[model samples]
Target chain A: MTETLTAPAPETHPRYAIEIDGVGKTYGSGDGAVTALDLVNLDVRKGEFISLLGPSGCGKTTLLRMIAGLEDPTQGSIWLPGRGLDGLGFVFQRDALVNWRTIIENVLLPLEFKGRRTKAAYQRARDLLATFGLAEFEDRNPWELSGGMRQRAAICRAMIDDPQLLLMDEPFGALDALTRDDLNFELQALWPDPEKTAVFVTHSINEAVYLSDRVVVISDKPGRIVDITEIPFERPRPLEIREEPEFGRIARHLRGVLDGHSARRA
Target chain B: MKKNPLAYIPMQVWTIVGIFAVWQACVMVLDIKPIILPPVPKVLGELFGNFGLYLRHGGHTLGNTLIAFAISVVAGVGMAIGIVYSKFLEKTLYTLLVTVNNVPKVALAPLFVIWLGTGNASKIAMGVLISIFAIVIDTVLGLRSLHPDLIDLGRAMRGSEFKVLMKLRLPNAMPSILAGMKVAISLALVGAIVGEFVAAQNGLGFVILSSQGAFRTDRVYASIIVLAAIGTALYYMMEYAEAKLIPWHESRRSHARPTAPSKPAKGPVAQPVASDAKA
Candidate 1:
């Protein structure tokens, strides 16, 4: 585990927690050309909740994959400032929770992966399940749990190792609107400590507007950020915040950008 | 279970009565001799009269079948793992296995008896030979058909191939393994009985052969019925075990729950968390 670096009184934010500079992903060579994410550059700041919002083929998942080290960027560099990314927790688009493992065991998977398989680690897992309101279903398999609870268990799994940089790809896209809103609130409640930075990728404009501190809108295929909008919402956001005029305004702006990008392509 | 256990007894009674009625009708109506298809009551008397001798032979045959089944299962699973782990071994050994599988082990049972003697070894060998191919093919398919994404997830977690094999591949391959085992169990029975027909002093196969030689047709029918019952028992036991072990598996789950829950959700919400440099 890397210790959090401190700067004198001023908030010395991570210049770029992830500096994705000139990253490119080309599927095949020669006549079969498919550049998924071309020369993509984005800098996520420390403690900033940034959402990579884009159209269907905008390479949002590709960008998230590069950040998570699941896929290597063909062109550029991605770095974690202050700490090397040994503690980066990744939540994939699909739940990816091992179906055979029970809810609490699933939560403890990261610890198991790290070879920290001790009684104390197990205690921590139990505590996490309780904290996340999954205490009643600790022994239930992923298949037995409802969709929202399964996702909650997946969240607990990702956070078990206390990752500093959490990368999620369309985590709530599959949930219904009400569940998604509830999860957004749950996410706000579970926000990492001040030093932690996160990057999220999603297709929903409202989801981007509701959750992120900064929403980076990207263009169509061979994705590049067309605009970076700073969210001006106050901390401790609630479900009712979605009904707020400013929230709707930001959402509308994002929708406009997405529509414009699609129009240009058409 | 929905079909009552006693239903078989009643069904058997009806079948025996109906067959006996037909035999009796032929004897009286057509004035047929009792030699070709003997009187029903006399045949029944003959069958019940030699019950102890039939049981002794049945036990021998079953023992041979069981021995063959156990050996085939172990050898099959071992060979499957070998094939899964090594490309060279798979390429070389798989061809030989398929070739051996195609050859009729029963045709060579006489030669096997000459080499190993007309004792248990020859019968066991025949049974093992018959079932081994089923096990190998099923286990290999099970080992190979593991989900690639699951493997990728394991790799992403830095789990070794051995760990993945034990934790993911083996468990996932269980249904296929059981399917193979079920087939192997039936084949082993056939092999055992067939081997007995070639050269066996004991076993139900020998009993059937002897009964036929003595022109005791009813005794032969009784032995055949006992063999069928044993085969059915073995198959049902395998099915029961499969049900007990993997209730979450789709095949088992369908029997467990008629209607499953819809819209299974997958994972957690995105949150900004401290990235552990050593995660």
Candidate 2:
């Protein structure tokens, strides 16, 4: 993947958090070998919420996984200079809440694994739960809650570690449209730090437009970026921004680019 | 409306009475001999008359069954953990469990008696052999059927395998494991009886055998009734524990707490007939 970003504006390199250079990932070998990503390159500025938007088999999830350190890239390197990515938190498509653990306890799981299970860690977990409107459900198991509630608890767990980077893989895809919108707003409100970097993979074009500062559109099969549209909306973007002509224009323009790529592949 | 929990007791009593009434009528109309078809009252009288004898044998058999059932639970869960932790062990051990489980456990009763003698040891072993299959099969399935996503989540959170088992797999599998134990309890009871039939000095199975040899059919049936009660009680106790431990599980929660009515009717016009018609 070759990156040819025209002229680098000062805003473009915010903090130069992640530099993906010519990463190619291939699975299996011989008849079974599948090239999921081919010649992929991208740069994520610090504190920016970037959405890797693509169709199925486009290696969007693979790219997100590589950034999260869940999968090693076959060719390129992923570096998190500031705070080190070993402390990165991930929110999965499924809630991934341990069914046996209560909501608060599930949120505290990262601390337990990291051997930082002090009383203060627990207090922080409870504080996070309260922020998410889950104080009353702190003692409730995952199965006892509704799907939306479970996903809320999942977000709390993901943020429990308070890492510099948060990797999300279609976190709100399984939710209903109404719940998904509510969560999107909730996420924007509780993003921890304005300068905290986030890499999200999603199939929904609208979700990409709503949650991301830059939407990285990718092609199918040998996944490679076709376009990176920078969203110019102001900070603390309210749901009302969706009705603005600029937001609609960018969204439509990205859709047209995606359509063209699909046409070429066909 | 609240469902009266007591409703089923009266239904059960009526069903039992109907069965006896049909039996009594058949015996009287057919003029069957008392030896062939003793009256229900006579059977009950014999059961109470020989209560001590029945209790002694019943206690022996129930003790053996309980012993076997307990061993099965421990061994099954242990084996399940072993198989899940290692793929090679699972492949080899699970194949053996399946093969042994498929073999009719009753066929092994005589061998057990020969090896362990005509004592409680053989009877307990026989029962264990019968019930172990259920525990192993269910526990393995429960352990292996955990969602892959949950495992990945645990790994992402940097959990050790031991922690994952303790915090996730074991608790998630509780309902299924309890279900398997309930099924095994009945089989364990049956196995004890079969062991007694093969060779035993005591137990309900021996009592039934002796009564049959003497042609005392009433005593035989009475022993059977006692055995059935014991088995039912054990199964329900497991069900009760399962309901308590996994209250969040859908199957358990629905039955754990009785639901309150949505709201009481406002008027006397909301009678049974009106409600039925509306339904």
Best by TM-score: 2
lDDT of 1: 0.75
Poorest stretch of ten by lDDT in candidate 1 chain B? B270-279
Worst window of 10 by summed lDDT in candidate 2 chain A? A1-10
Clash totals for all candidate models: 16, 2
Which predicted model would earn the best DockQ? 1
| lDDT (tens digit, per residue) of candidate 1 on A111-198 | 6666777898788888887776788888876666666777777778777777778888888777777677777888876654576677
lDDT by residue for model 1 (B156-205), tens? 45556777777677776777778889999999999999889998899999
Per-candidate DockQ values are 0.24, 0.20
Q: For model 1 chain A, where is the 10-residue window of minimal lDDT? A: A1-10
State the lDDT at A81 in candidate 1.
63
Model 1 residue A183 lDDT score: 77
How would you encode candidate 2's per-residue C-alpha lDDT over A1-266 as one tens digit per residue? 11212222334343766767677789998998898888788878877889999887789998887776667777766555555554678898877776556788889888777778889888998898888777888887665566667778888888888876788889887777777777788887754365578888898888898888899999886788899998877667688888889888988998888888773658
